[model samples]
Target: MPDTQLTVTLSGEGVGDARVVVRALEQAFGAPDELPSDEKATVHMATFTGEARAEGSPTAPGHLSAPVAVTVQGAPGAVRRASETLARAFTTRDEGAASGDQEQERQLLLEP
Candidate 1:
């Protein structure tokens, strides 16, 4: 199977909060292939490879009580699964539209 990549970008007040969001992503997608630069960075990023699954770990309230943007790129199936997991983890606001033709991609804007 082709490798799937999911990149989650979190913008919030503190980096600690961002880390919490990253941890939530880790719970959903397994250990990330890459993590954000430092704790001081405002906009943090976490990249995960392969399929994403819910680990049953609950994220803290304040962690996602901000604005977050997630992007999933991979096979159609993988992207759909990742998007679903993230949508559930983030909120039930809206189902983000999917784009890209050959290489599938989905962009989700989440708010807590």
Candidate 2:
């Protein structure tokens, strides 16, 4: 299996909101080591980025956040489910999402 990325975002009041978001994700999808370790399934994690969005409201209330992007190389269905759940768990709205190889495959420049 190849490496992948995952992003989880939380949007709400103050800087502490992000931490709540992270906790929600960990609960929903499991921790970094908990994802799965297999020749066919390798889950690698990247730290999420949070920034205040003065742009008013989405589904919750005032302010918003950048979506956390996650990537990985392995099972497609599992990855997609994990991604969706992560978003749904964090906020009252679906603020988080996971984009796998499909999103990754398009960008060559991101390669190391």
RMSD of 1: 3.4
Among all candidates shown, the one with the greatest TM-score: 1
lDDT tens string, model 2, 12-111?
A: 2323333434444444333433322233322233242222223222232122244323332234443454454444543333223445655421101010
- Candidate 2's displacement at residue 77, Å, is 4.9
**Alpha-carbon deviation at 46 in model 2, angstroms:** 6.0
- Which residue ranges in model 1 land beyond 4 Å of their true spot? 50-62, 92-98
TM-score of each: 0.64, 0.33
Please write out the lDDT profile of model 1 over residues 1-112, one tens digit for every residue.
Answer: 4355666666666566566556665665677776665766767777778565645655543446566655556667666666666665666344355666755766666676
Clashes of 1: 0
Candidate whose lDDT is highest: 1
TM-score of structure candidate 2: 0.33
